[model samples]
Target chain A: MISSKWVVLVIYAMEDGPVRYGEFSRRIEGISKKMLTQTLRQLERDGLIERDIHPTVPPAVEYRLTALGESLLPFMRQLKTWAAANLPLVEAARTRFDAQSLAE
Target chain B: MISSKWVVLVIYAMEDGPVRYGEFSRRIEGISKKMLTQTLRQLERDGLIERDIHPTVPPAVEYRLTALGESLLPFMRQLKTWAAANLPLVEAARTRFDAQSLAE
Candidate 1:
């Protein structure tokens, strides 16, 4: 579940508060409807998120992170912070690697 | 590099100290030689690992984690610890979800 690239994206999208399905699609750019549905189901099944249905003319569905999921936020945030800070270094390394590879 | 499953395995294998290529092949089960080589190259290019070659009749080579890589250890370890502690909960949730899906 953690290995899925979409997992982190989806988790972060919901970091602020409960989110609707449509909102998730909009917030997480480049996610297909099928992938979003699948990711949400997987997260729910993993007990990381909870899906709630509100009674209305058309039942509204919202997803929020569970306590278990909330517990993961710090770790994910740390990784994200590290990535944000170090991405430039990675890009520079990639450029050098590609250049050397071409030279060889 | 972080998304690649083999990356973590290789990093952990080298966690204790420097490890030979052949030893990595042995320690990380089911990793193809090609995949291992590619992963190591990527890690080295990302500056997360250093490859050292020793002069010998049949030269010796070993891979070790770099400072940046060492910095990532705590975060990885925390995730590993969380996974170890919560895996059973996830498994239980999966079983429940599967059964519920079957019933539906």
Candidate 2:
């Protein structure tokens, strides 16, 4: 669950506060509506996010991170930083490993 | 890749340095051999781990975190800390959300 891209990005997108369903989908590019809905429901179930439903014409739905979810932000930011810093090294390692395999 | 349990634990198990294949399996409870193998291959492909094969009667296979993988440990530890601290809150949120769903 912690390793899920949709879960991570959904939580990331909502970190700034309430986000509508449409905006959420747009923020996480290449995500299907079905996948977006699934991730939202799962995140909500896990108590990481809150869904707000308004009594308007078509009904407004927005998501915000819960206190629990907010607590995870610093950690997420750290992971993001670590990944960014090591991406080049990781890529180089992959290239070396792949070439070694092809040679063997 | 980052979200895989086997990947996390496999990496976690090696935080202390190199570990044999058997030790890796034992360290992470409930992971199947097939899944473990797959995770190892994927992690190696991504340059997060290195697999050392030694010449022995049956050959020795040990896994160790790459420099890139080691760089991720601090971030991983932070994540573990956050998860521990917020677990109760997350669980409570889940309970409330579940009850609400049942009622709806």
Candidate 3:
């Protein structure tokens, strides 16, 4: 199964168009090389991305989101928007929940 | 930040309405008691759910999704639908990718 967070991150990161492996590595910060490789492979396996290898001196490679992958963006974007807008509400709730429990 | 998978699962599982702690454990097959509690707390803190405690011999508690949480269902359902429909394609891609690596 796909790691949903990485799946969303990679797909959203590649939203523009094709990106080479090194470029993807550069774009998403804090992703370990192993995790990045694994996430890419899994996304490829899931048909969310197409990895194209060009036959060159060292074989250049690139990645892009597939139609299936693009299909997820609208929903992902909406969630991102919702989260951003409601963060303060969520934080306030956490504060209240903690204080209530502390008093009990 | 939310643990997206559990957030989705718990929200979807509670789509019906309010549910008690013990019942939530029963409904979600693999969630441990500790994990269930933690996930619930996080969701509550996020203001996605309202947890109500009734006064009784012992306190009875129940959970229900808030309007903000229900607002996400449309997008979630679409992704779920897309995933279900394209699962075969993803499986095929994985098999081909694996076979390709093995052959190389």
What is the descending TM-score order?
2, 1, 3
lDDT at A37, model 2: 93
Sum up the clashes in candidate 2. 1
The TM-scores of all predictions, comma-separated, are 0.86, 0.91, 0.80
lDDT score, candidate 3? 0.80
**Model 1 lDDT, residue A13, Cα:** 79
Best by TM-score: 2
True contacts kept of each: 0.56, 0.87, 0.60
Cα misplacement distance, residue A88 of candidate 1 (Å)? 0.6
lDDT of 2 at B37: 92
Q: After superposition, how far is residue A60 of candidate 1 from its true place, in Å?
A: 3.3
lDDT of 1 by residue, B2-104 (tens): 8766887888888889999889988989999999999999898998898899897699889999888787888778887998999898888889989999999
Estimate the overall C-alpha local distance difference test score of candidate 1. Answer: 0.86
Q: Chain B alone: TM-score in each candidate?
A: 0.81, 0.89, 0.77
Q: Per-residue lDDT for B52-73 in model 3, tens only? A: 9989769999899888777767
Alpha carbon lDDT of each predicted model: 0.86, 0.82, 0.80
Cα misplacement distance, residue B85 of candidate 3 (Å): 1.9
Candidate 2 true-interface contact recovery: 0.87
- Which stretches in model 3 have alpha-carbon errors above 4 Å? A95-104, B101-104
TM-score of chain A, predicted model 3, versus the true chain A, to 2 decimals: 0.77
Could you tally the backbone clashes for each prediction? 0, 1, 0
